[model samples]
Target: MELGLEVAEGPAPYTVLAVKGEVDVYTAPRLREKLVELVSQGKHQIIVDLEGVDFLDSTGLGVLVGGLKRLRSNDGDLSLVCTQSRILKVFEITGLTKVFSIYDSVDGATAS
Candidate 1:
């Protein structure tokens, strides 16, 4: 699994959570917990960089949606930086491409 994360300061308070490997039913919850913990710690705005993620299942998508709602409840937002067409398709098929802010790169996500 290439899943990893690197958090840095951005224009507005933000976190770049880089996701690698496969995001399936088993790993989705772990990722969700990580995001939830960050939100709980006051890290509201986040950019999930999925360049390294080769695959993502419905469960993974659910985790992201759940996180988005959780953050929004606290006046926060979640954005995604994904390059893979396959992963993007999942978001599109699920109509989540419209639900979450999508970007092409981490720089774009953080800069936007």
Candidate 2:
């Protein structure tokens, strides 16, 4: 599946990247590239809104973790706004739910 990204203004100088679509090995790299560029540009605080995502695999999880690591290294933060049960199950099973801050909604993620 293809990925769609939309940037919206969030709290302060944060940029909320609203991501929609399946995030697997193929598409995950695209996200990683964008996030890396953003981080390099000093845009550290980011919220990845996964509310529209329908599927996620191990590669996708890796992408999220990579982003978190990159942000943390830059003294920034990365959060998630995912409400999908199936996706949430993967995060829980992989213990990523604790690694990445998760919120019930995009608004909440942006707010926090």
Candidate 3:
């Protein structure tokens, strides 16, 4: 499936990035570029909504980690919005569940 990325301003200091589709090596670059673009544009607090993602690989995880690091270095943070068991499993298996704040919904992510 094709990757889709929709970015929007969150309640206050957050930017919500809604992503759907496969996020393997092939599509991970696009997501990384979007994260870089957002950061460059001064959007520090980012909530990556992965509820629609059907597949994710190591490359995608690396991208998220990189984005989180970048944001944190800027005194900001990166959160994730995801509820799919399959997708959440990747984080759990990789121990990234503890590294990234994973929320069930965009609203929940934005609240924190």
Candidate 4:
């Protein structure tokens, strides 16, 4: 399945990227592209709402990490909102749960 990306402005100066569908080798590049575009647009504070993502792979994780690095380089940050146990397991197993600031809801992510 193809990935669906929705970009929107969130609280104050933060940008929100809501992603749906699966994120794998085939679709990860799209996510990467959107992230790069947002960073290029000088949008450093980003909230990635992955509540609709059903599956995530190493490449997807890499993309998120890359996005975080890019934002942090600009003195910004990337927060994630993911509530699925399966998807959350991927982050836990990879120890990325410690790398990114994760929240259960977009509201919570944006508030922080």
Candidate 5:
């Protein structure tokens, strides 16, 4: 499956990255590059909306961790909008649920 990425403005102090499709090894690089580009543009507080994502592998998780680290290094943060059980399980099993500020909706993440 392919990975679709869209960049948009979020609530104050945040930028939203709407993601669709699968995020596997082949497509992970695209997501990583976009995150890097956003951080380079000083968009450090990011909200990755994974509502449209159907699948996510370890490589995808790594990309997110990398992005989070990058943002934190810049005194910013990376949050996630993901409610799917399968995807949430990935974060949970990886112990990343505690690391990332994940919410059910964009509004939820923005409020935090």
Candidate 6:
């Protein structure tokens, strides 16, 4: 299935992007576009909830890292909410677990 992306305003300074479905090379660009749109709108503090994402590939990781870099350059941060062990393992194995502020829930990510 195709990727599903949803943007929502959270608390001050935090914009939440709820993503579902597979995020592969073909769909990574869509994710990138959403992130770029958010950054362009000056909504940098982002929480990408990947709880619904069933699959994630290297291109997906690249888009996420790119988004994090863009946000950091603007003095903002990009956090992640991913409870699925499969998805978490991707970050862990790639050593990106150290690069992102990962949380168990959206509330936890937004609070911090």
Candidate 3 weakest ten by summed lDDT: 103-112
Q: Summarize candidate 5's per-residue lDDT along 1-112 as a digit string, tens digits.
A: 7789999898778899999999999999999999999999999899999999999999999999999999999999999999999999999999999999999999999998
User: Each model's C-alpha lDDT?
Assistant: 0.85, 0.87, 0.95, 0.95, 0.95, 0.95
RMSD to native for every prediction?
1.5, 1.1, 0.6, 0.6, 0.6, 0.6
- In terms of lDDT, which candidate is stronger, 1 or 4? 4
Backbone clash pairs for candidate 3 read none
lDDT of 2 by residue, 18-92 (tens): 889988888999888888888988889999988889888899888889999999998999999888899899999
In angstroms, give how far residue 25 of model 2 lies from its true place. 1.3
Clashes of each: 0, 0, 0, 0, 0, 0
Clashing pairs for predicted structure model 1, backbone only: none
Tens digits of per-residue lDDT for model 4, 1-112: 9899999999878899999999999999999999999999999999999999999999999999999999999999999999999999999999999999999987898777
lDDT of 1 by residue, 31-106 (tens): 8888988898899998888888888998989899999999899998999998788888998888887899999987
Alpha carbon lDDT at 34, candidate 3: 100
Instruction: Please say which candidate is ahead in lDDT: 1 or 3.
Output: 3
Worst 10 residues of 6 by lDDT: 103-112
lDDT of 3 by residue, 18-104 (tens): 999999999999999999999999999999999889999999999999999999999999999989999999999999999999998
After TM-score superposition, what is the CA distance of residue 39 in candidate 2 from its true location, in Å? 0.6
lDDT of candidate 6 over 1-104, digit per residue (tens): 88999999998878999999999999999999999999999997999999999999999999999999999999999999998999999999999999999999
Which pairs in model 5 have colliding backbones?
none
Q: List residue ranges in candidate 4 displaced over 4 A.
A: none
lDDT of 1 at 57: 96
